[model samples]
Target chain A: MPFPQFLFPNSKFPSQVRNIFLFIRRYFNLLLFLFLQGFSIYLIVHNSRYHNAIFGSITNQLTGKVNEQFSRVEYYFQLKKTNDSLVKANAKLYNKLKADFELPDTTSNIFVDSLKVDSIETYRKYNYYPAKVVYNSVAAQNNYLVLSRGTAQQVRSGMGVIDPNGSVVGVVTDVSKDFAVVMSLLHKDSHIEGMLLKATRKQAHSAGMAWRPISLTFPGYRKVRKWLWETASYQVATVPAYQKV
Target chain B: MNTLVKNIVRFALFILVQVYVLDKIHLHQMVTPYIYFLFILWMPFRMKRTWQMLVAFALGFTLDSFHHNPGFHAAACVLIAYIRPFLVNLLIPQEGADTNYEEPSFKSMGGFLPYFIFTGVLTLIHHGWLFLLEAWQFGNIWYFIFKTLLSTAVSLVLIVVTELLFARKQSFRTNTA
Candidate 1:
């Protein structure tokens, strides 16, 4: 090794130092690859454990914008299907409207108007806000749905999401400026309690846990199977934090 | 200038198709076609390896953002990008003989058989790493293997079809450039 004597005139390990530099220069690509791989693994471990605070927020905003735009194109293609579902939901709601029914004549009977009519405010416990699903996937173990509504529209984490027909969709997990991430019911960690209306007399209840074969395949738990199978008609509403089922 | 523009367009097209179209098609829970790695695979051989890895990281990170899995794709992509030059050298021993071929394609890799093998091996490695990181356990080893193999098969088919469709056009453009 013809080492430059001027740079390290008195150094005893100058040749070794030069060799180290040569090795680094020779395999710099491999070093870079390992560094990048380690960075990616770090990101995975960090983001998978808890809500990512730094890069997550920035990437979430960008992905939210792009998905929102892409979903518009998809929404256009599915306009007919969306219109049909909306019509069906409309018909169902229209039949339950107060204007569709009239009180029968009760002239022969004594009328009692002791109950206060303006007490509906006490019974109104929940409010529903409409939002579009900008992105959704059922293929992953931990599936998440992104909604177009976010903090801008008063959407907050821990809020429940429901479809047009009032079926449980998901629960809000993260919120950005113009978008929110919902942990869908198909996720492995999503646990929901489903009540069986037909067994109301018996007080039979079932826990609706998603993606668990033990819950679905248990032979003795016919009630659980029935509730899980009747996903269309049966409704799972989010109970208030203060209330217990 | 033309090659740069062409690669940029290819990058956008690959990301869009992979995220929007291929992701929506739920063929099975185990089989996901990840043909987006073809962007890195098709990168020019003359480009620096460090730059290739960086580009692969960006591509994988972009896909990861959309899928909500932050690092799995990025790790797999970087690994493949790092190994791509070695695979090319092993497969095509002669260097200056095919100097005109700017990128690896059917014609550049000598023939369809070599290209197929090259693509299949890389796809297998990429999918294996991704699915392994995704499952992150050996409890279901069979499940992991099946998922990797099935996804590799699907991705290979899509990649070969894409190459067949666009390889000639790419070679023509490279020649003109």
Candidate 2:
């Protein structure tokens, strides 16, 4: 006539049923805690494929939107820095322009202008696309940078990223609808090929002509150019003025 | 109702700070402070155990979404949530006398020492679990331990400073109760 007996009329384990009910009631919180923990572990173990396909996209979209909004506020604070970098980049580009270099001392050397302007189009090798960095980090072991450009802007994985001053930043690893994640050069796994210019005695002595190539692997090479330039300048300064023919 | 509103606002603020601000600060490779776990540490003591775990899970999941790691934060959050009651009960002997204390804080947990120990232990445990899971290997046990300790120290300092700066006074708690 008891509830457990009535529910299990054909069974002889009514006491076991009652005990099970008591156990569930006594440890309901533990049961719920275990369930939540188990679910989270399941998510972690299956995160690469199953979770990414279903929940990852949705959360990515939400987080991307929120990060984009937050980055707008951050962008204001970084306006001066960004502008400074841009101006420096502009000056560097202007210095490289053909107009910047006049007929270099025509009296000392004969110069011939035989190249056609229309033929310059065939020499283009690389295309540049500018994207705003919505999020970036340099402190983590595996650093990543998020850009505002994505598939909609033709940003895809395997594309190399560069800063305004033509320095290598990273490579795009993942792209969503409106955002892309770049694996920064600072990342542990990022290896880039770079040429080390060794200024030999002969080259260093010659003013404005010190470029000798030595191949090297550049991992986090942001300061290599500056450091090498400084050393080369020091070498040049130490050389006697009589060496400058 | 007021407490509920306050908690909701706290949730939003914690998430924003964790994702937008703390996550951006590149202090060091080994000293990434994760004070968001403080949300679980500061939840109302009288809250139902189930609700506490649920809220912790939600907080962790939201952080994981931003971090691009599906369940690391969620697992750590739930573990801390489950152990919090036991930790509080173990530390605070006179819980019945201080029923007016809405949540764990510098003022509620008696004084500075007990509060620091309480939050410090929780932060250590949370960081250990989270970092271990992130490493997912015993190959570099020393590196993992160093990272856990460094991060725990930073997070504990941030937690204590936040409590000192923004934690409501005990007088406010008495009035609310």
* Chain B structural similarity as TM-score, candidate 1: 0.91
Return the top candidate by lDDT. 1
lDDT score of residue A116 within candidate 2: 42
lDDT string for model 2 (A66-178, tens) is 88998999999999999999998899777767666686533222122236466323332355788998777766545677788878888767777777755556667667888
Can you tell me the CAPRI class of model 1?
medium
In candidate 1, which residue pairs get closer than 3 Å at backbone N, Cα or C atoms, i.e. clash? none
In candidate 1, clashing pairs total 0
Q: What is the lDDT of residue A58 in candidate 1?
A: 79
lDDT string, candidate 2, B1-177, tens digits: 577898889888999998788988878767887888888987888798889999999999998877665788899899999999988887774746347677887777777888888888889889988877766622356667888999998887888788778857554345444
Can you tell me which runs of candidate 1 are displaced by over 4 Å?
A1-26, A49-51, A95-123, A197-208, A212-233, A237-245, B137-139, B169-177
Instruction: Tell me how far the alpha carbon of residue A45 in candidate 2 is from the true structure, in angstroms, after superposition.
Output: 5.2
Model 1 chain B weakest 10-residue run by lDDT: B167-176
Model 1: per-residue lDDT, tens digit, B56-168? 99999998888776888999999999999888888873655345677888778887888888898899999999888876622356678888999998898898788767655
